[model samples]
Each structure stands twice: as C-alpha cells, then as structure tokens.
Target: MDPRSPPPGDGRLTPADLRLWAVLGLALVFLALAALFLAAPALGALIYGVPAPEGIGRTALRAIGARDAALALYLAGLALFSTRRAVAIVLAASLVIPACDLVLILSAGTAAWWQVALHGVSAGVLALTALWLARRNHSA
Candidate 1:
C-alpha cells in the first residue's frame, strides 16, 4: 500500500487531512477562548471576589461552552474523516464567535484593559493560525 494514498478503509488522513486538522485545531483554541470569556464571571467568582452580573453571565457561559464543545467535536470529526472543507467551515465560524465576543467586551466598558488585551491577543492568534492553515492546506 502506498503511504501517499488515503488511509485504508474509512479512517485515513493525508497531508490535506493534517491541514484540515490544523484549521480545526485553531478553531478549538478560539472556541476555548470564547468559552473563557463567557465563563469569565463564573471563573472570577470561583477565583476572585468580583461579582458577576445576573442571569446574563450564566446564560452566556452556557452558550459559549456549549458551542465550544460542539466545535471541538466537529474538529474531532475532521480528524476522523480527514476532510478539509467541512473543518474549514467550522473553523471559520469559530473565528467569528471570538471576534464578536471581543467587540462585545470592548463595548461593554466594564472589563479591564488587560483583559481586553489578553482576549484580543488570543483572538488574533487563533485567526492567524487558521489563516496559516488555510494557506498550507494542500501541504498539510
């Protein structure tokens, strides 16, 4: 069997497969970031003395983590099937979620500068990674 050929049976991943994996990996990271943002209050309450908003924070956290988990599962699917387009679409959606979170956090005006910076950096890293993966998709 040629190593260059797709995996035997149904589970085979090639260079292109890896590229898709990279995309999905980046998405997972971003989804994690978004989850962190949404879970900020719960996190803070768990850690610091800062008071969280009412039901809003809880709802947001649930949504964020739920989506993040879903994205992670999709990423796992990419790994299993070795398909690029499907993973790319999921990753692209992952990117948008964090960008929206960044905008919301900035507009909310309650968060500290450092928190904004951290989230911004995380979002940038995720986007950059996905872009690189897309560019190197064929080589993966």
Candidate 2:
C-alpha cells in the first residue's frame, strides 16, 4: 500500500495526513509549557492566573508541571505510535484537566476574566476536538 494513501478515516481531514495534527499540536504545546512550568514555577503560576506563589505553593506548581509533562508524553506517544482512536480516547479523558482548572480558578475568585475564559475555551476546544475525531473516525 502507498504510504501516501493513509487508510480511510483515522480522523485525518485528508488521506495523506497522519493522526490529526491537532493531537500532535496539542502535545507539542503541552511539552513546551511543561518545560516552562518546570523551569520557572512562579512564572507558570502567573501565566495560569495564579498570583506569585510563595514557599510551598511553588511545589504545587511544580507538581502541575510534572503532570503536564507526563500527559504530554503520553499524548505524543499515542499520536505517533498508537491508533487515532487511542488519541481520541486519551484526549477525551484529559478534558477533566481544563474543566477542573476552570472550576478551580473561578472558585478562587482571583482570576481575571481572560484567565477563566482561557480555561473554558481550552475545555471547549478539547471537547469539540475529541468528538470530532470520534465521529470522523467512525464515519469517514
């Protein structure tokens, strides 16, 4: 079979495409962010809308960074080596991250509107992308 002719579906908009670029794109994004958060927890917290952390608070940010890095590896690994369905399943499951972040940030009442909106939009996009991949995987 021609490598150019990817099997039908797999969530690619075109036959020549690999596991949707969105999956890989998101993975790369997370990886970059993970590095930033790991290297500079305070800055990462600020970017995430948290005020500059003090003392032990930085530990939590580091934990978040670690988690993000781990998730990024899993996502990228799946996109590269596993099936598209696996990527969709993982992406769908990962929705809890942004959803919980939105809720937590909102409940804290310390976040600006854009921060809250960012999380909300992230959750929305992840949900939509997961659904699109699933539906397209089934029908295309």
Candidate 3:
C-alpha cells in the first residue's frame, strides 16, 4: 500500500471529516438547549401546578445550560488538533446523560411526553452525526 494512502481500520479522521462531525455535534447541542427551554416549563406545569416542579424544573434548566456549555467547549475543541478526540468524547458523553434522564422521568410515572419527544429527536440527530463521523473516520 502507498504510504500516503490511509490504511484500513486506522481510526483516523481527516480535518474536513472532523469539521463535519463538529458542526453536527454543535447543532445537536443547540437543538437540545432550544427544546429544553421551550419544553421544560410546559412540562413542569403539566406535572406540578401553577408554581412549577422545582426539582425537575431545576434539572431541566441545568441540562439546558450544560448543553450550551458543552457546545462551546466542543467548538473550541474542534479548532484545536489535540482536542479533536476530546470533542468527540464529550459529544458522545452528552448523549448518555439525557438518556438516563429520560429513563428516570419515565420511571417517575409523570407523563413526560414532551421530554421523551425532545430527547428522541435530539438523540436521533446526535446518533446520525456520530455515525457519520465514525464512518468518515474509518474511511480516512
């Protein structure tokens, strides 16, 4: 094989490939934040009363802020060569937190339909982005 050609299964991603992944990840983070902002208060109203469910509301707010912060960090990482894998790892980690939250909400028997919908949509987007990134990395 030519030395210039990447070997099969080398697990390396080109800069362009990495950029695509980063963009998709950043989009997911923003989408999640937006959805949380719109949905969380409504969800709180449905589950609790006019006041709001303090515990769940607080958690949702935190998730929104965390997602935004994660996106900022992800973009910064994307620009730094040493942080490429770190960005991917952080994006990957973001997926798990929401999933666990979904499970917890479901177990509470609180009829968290909006949360499920938002989480499903966000997860689908993130998963697709991650898959594209992985495939591009593999091909590189």
TM-scores for the candidates: 0.60, 0.82, 0.53
The better candidate by lDDT, 2 or 3, is: 2
RMSD versus native structure for model 3: 6.4
Ten residues in sequence with the least summed lDDT for candidate 3: 43-52
Candidate 2 ranges beyond 4 A from true positions: 1-15, 137-140
lDDT of each: 0.57, 0.77, 0.55
Worst 10 residues of 1 by lDDT: 44-53
Tell me the spans in candidate 3 whose CA falls farther than 4 Å from its real position: 1-51, 54-60, 79-86, 137-140
Question: lDDT winner among the candidates?
Answer: 2
Candidate 1: give the clashing pairs.
15-140
Q: Which digits, one per residue and each the tens of the lDDT, describe model 1 over residues 24-88?
A: 56557646655674556477333212235567656755565666667667676775576444454
Using TM-score, give the best candidate's number: 2
lDDT by residue (2-90, candidate 2, tens digit) is 77554565533433544457777788788888898889998887778778688888888888889889888988787776667677788
Clashes of 1: 1
Clashing pairs in 3: none
Give lDDT: candidate 3, residue 75: 47
Candidate 1 stretches greater than 4 Å from native: 1-41, 44-51, 55-57, 136-140
